[model samples]
Each structure stands twice: as C-alpha cells, then as structure tokens.
Target: MAPRRCPCGTGLTYDGCCGRLHDGTATAGTAEQLMRSRYSAFAVGDPAYLLATWHSSTRPGRLELDPDVRWTGLEVLGTTGGSLLAAEGTVAFRASRLDDGVPGVQAEDSRFVREGGRWVYLDGVPLR
Candidate 1:
C-alpha cells in the first residue's frame, strides 16, 4: 500500500511530515511547523498529539474530537516570526472541514510560543 499524504497539505507522506512529530520521533523546529502538525493531528483524529503540543498556559485538561467532523484541508495564509530562533509567532490559516456532511471553513490567526525549547500552541483569534 502507498503511504498516505499528510493532511497538513505538505507534499510529503504522513510519516515524513507530521506523523514523525505526532509519534515523538521528531520535534517541530518552528511555530509554523507545529501549527501544521496540529492541523494534521486533527485531520488524523489524534487528540493526544494536539494536547501534547499545546502550551501549558492554555492547554485544556482533555480534548474530545468530534467524530462527525472530518478535516479536509489546511491553507497557511501567512506567518510572522515563529522561526527556529524566535520565541513566538503567529500563523494565519483557513482550515476546511465537513461537519456531518456540511462543508465549512475555520479561519484563525493562531499564536505559538517556544516552551522548553520546543514550539507549542498558545491560542488563536478567530477570523471573521
């Protein structure tokens, strides 16, 4: 069987892209990379990876993904900072999904920060 493509929209296989991050074999080098991996986590239904990458300041006690929602695509609109040496950054993206067969898109400007030398998700501002 062929390897599955990464849902983060990177032109790479899941294992070569977000899967390595999700499985702990690698760590995200930048905030944008972390953000993409998080989107892939949601697409693949792995809440554990999502929670693990969440910043401690904003992480919830637990996460429950809606089984009826299927993530279809991720488009990174822009980025500011969040590089390998930066302590913080923001990613603007639009994520497409289907909720019980209803199509929808979520646009947000998400913030990220470096914690313990690893990038982690901080929070996001919903875009109108």
Candidate 2:
C-alpha cells in the first residue's frame, strides 16, 4: 500500500505529518504534537502506535476499527497544559468521518496524561 496522508488533507503525506514521530525521527515533545500524531495514526490504521501511545492505566487491549468508516479530516481547535512533565492535559478538535451511510463530525475534547516521561491518550469528553 502507498503511504498515507494526514486527515487534515494537507497533502504532505503521513510521514511528514506524524509518521516521522511514530517512526522515531521526531519525538512528540509537546502534547499538541502527540495529539496530532495520534490522529494521524488513526487515519493510517496504525493501532499499534495508538496502543503504545496510550497510557497503560486507560489503554485498551484492542482498538476496534469499523470497516465501513473512513476518517476524513482533523481540525485541532486548541490545547492546554500539555507541556512537558505536566500531569494532564486536554486537546479539543473536530474529527470528520463517513460511516454507516452518514457523513458527519465528532467534535471532542480529549484528555491525556503524562506517565513515565511520556504522554498517553486517555479518552475524550465530547463537546457536542
């Protein structure tokens, strides 16, 4: 398969967007970077990276990907307190997708926590 593109439709390629980070070239030094990379992982079906980046406490054993769903784009609206060594943080964004005969968006405010010197995705609290 060809390399994936970011959900943001940047046309820059996933490697340029987040693959590099997941591949270990560029580390997600900030919460925002980690958040974007996580989104890119989802778009590319890289569940291993997702599981690896998720906090162990909250990490699930599997990520269930719907076969009919296609993630369209990612629009990160904002983030707060994701600085290095912070205990916790939040990322707010809009993730667009097409699934089950419907095209729509999942606007969410996701939470994260720093553990063992890394940031891990916890879950999201949707904001309508």
Against the reference, the lDDT scores of all candidates come to 0.96, 0.80
lDDT tens per residue, model 1, 86-122? 9999999999999999999999999999888899999
lDDT of 1 at 69: 100
What does the lDDT read for residue 89 in candidate 2?
87
lDDT of 2 by residue, 1-128 (tens): 98777655557787787878778787777777788888777777777888889988888978877777778888888898888767788989998888876898989998888777777888888877
Tell me model 2's lDDT, rounded to 2 decimals.
Answer: 0.80
**Which one is best on lDDT?**
1
TM of each candidate vs. truth: 0.98, 0.83
Clashing pairs in 2: none
Model 1: runs farther than 4 Å from truth?
Answer: none
